[model samples]
Target: MASNSYCESCSEEGKPIAAIRFCSDCEERLCKEKNRNDNINESEKLESAVYEEVKNWKNHIIKQINTVVEKLEIDLSNCKKKNLDQVRKDNAKISELYDSVKEKEQELKFLKEHGSNNQLYLKLRKQRKGIKDVVKRVSEMTMSYKRTLLKFEKKAEIDLNSMGSIFEVKEACDIQYKPVKLQQAQVQLVRVESLLTLKKVKTNQLNLSDRLCLSDIAVTADNTLCLCNYDYGVCEIYVYRTYLDDLTYSSTLHLPSEPYGISILTGTDKAVVTLPHKSYVQFINTEHLKLDKTIRVGEGWYGITTTGDYIVVSNTKEIRILKKMGEILGTLQ
Candidate 1:
């Protein structure tokens, strides 16, 4: 809490007095006075306005649904008209064929009873031909006729709660807070002096079997440096002691795939490294100077770092933030 010179509790004396130290009750009284900043007089008006807005939204959605329903009804009416017309035409053709058959039957009976051999033969043949034509017409009509079926396809559904959201508006300076300024001494808690410049101290190189492309390096708790190198299509890690003035080679790790980057997680020995073009990360047991185990995090791993409870990995395209147990948290492009 910041100090105040004016006494808030003793202001009834008609003169101002400097407050040396405030008690708990005085602080509480001041806080209660400050808490009275809320003006609840317009709450009923706000409630009415919000209720009107909700009603408007509901009406708008219902109107859209009704419009769609009306359109569907019109289409259904047109479909019924078309289907009835086709059915009526089919019925008319069948009735005409029936009437013609009845007339032919009478002609066949009259010719059989009164006609000579030539007339009987010609009439019978013509009647058979007409019957065959009628049969063909009926068969064709039945085969060519199609039955149409209509279905109510629900392509979407309305979720009223998911349509929008309601939230409290917190404008600027709505919350009372005391801004604390850090002292200059507190600012430098991690470092006594700042780094000004760099100077060459010592330089040495470790020879490997193939070409070296130093991808990433990390310092372990053992005061050693583990360098991840992509060595001529092979993954290799070279360990070296950094406490000595001269670089001392410690050991080399051979991997089946090429390595991308390395990061330390409480090391002098143990570390983590990502494999290039691989979907997993290998844990380096620097104590045993060997790979402990591997966890499948993501694909196209390029660079990686351990921050608090998360392991952030990055490729050329995007970054994958993951938990320690290979759970994918999120991604950034």
Candidate 2:
């Protein structure tokens, strides 16, 4: 004998139909008609829910995009205003220099043409020297201003590209859910102690003819230390193998200029050393212990660092960004 299961939804009806199938998700036995109606209703509910969620998400994204765009607009506007203000100030300075030079020229002409005293002639010579100095300073200032303008343009271009990427990402945003498999994290435990013991292992002395005036040092992956000796009489780079206990002198290479700062290039067997007074950085091959090439940076290159395909050197007044071959990209004051 087969026992019939009545539909859960319409069981109280006079003529309750027999349940033909069981829904695992709903945990109910339903008749054909009732099951069909429930499925249609469930699909409609799911569709409505999905539509509402997507609408909310879209609105949220729109709000975020608007906020970011507004911020970018404000930042760009501020930058423009600041650059314009600087340009105005520079122009005023240029005008002032022009006027001063013109006045000095008029004064010199008058003194040279009409004055007869030796003192007046000496004064004219001094005025001419002062005018030359002013002109040189003006030329330097103009170059600096041009560099600043170029930097601003580059920055603006980068910002615009970033904004475009953001918009592209927003447009490509699609709602998707995926099942992710998670693995247990592996953690290692290390022993900790309250007091640490320290002991002196070994010490080795460096024997050199010249005075020890070490300016910069760089260590290789193989425990080889390269030291720059900035002594005027003996400008040399010394390489030493750092053993477990002591250092052994490996090799020494002489440099033409005094090395001020040194930095190892990433993923390379080379180091860049800056010569402050000489206005150049020498690229030395650490493995071969020889000078590879030299790049003229600028005067007073005290600090140096390498990033990607560029080398950044710091002079006293400004930081100059250069390519590996010594092409000056930009300057930061």
Question: Model 1: which residue pairs collide?
Answer: 220-267, 220-268, 221-267, 221-268, 222-268, 269-286, 270-286
Give all TM-scores, in the order shown: 0.46, 0.40
Give the winner by TM-score: 1
- Candidate 1 stretches with Cα past 4 Å from truth are 1-38, 146-165, 174-295, 298-321, 324-333
lDDT at position 236, candidate 2: 81
Expressed as tens digits, the lDDT of each residue in 172-197 for candidate 2 is 31212222211011112233456778
Please give the CA lDDT of all the candidate structures. Answer: 0.72, 0.74
The CA root-mean-square deviation of candidate 2, after full C-alpha superposition on the true structure, stands at 20.3
Pairs in clash, predicted candidate 2: none
Give a tens-digit lDDT track for model 1, residues 1-333.
Answer: 233444555455444554433233224222333233223435567778888998898899889989989999999899889889988988898899889988998887898899888898998887787889989998998899888776677656655555466677865533323322332111222323668999998878677655878888888777777888876576788888877687788988877578888888742345778886677898878877877778897668888998766788888889989876778999999
Clash counts for all predictions: 7, 0
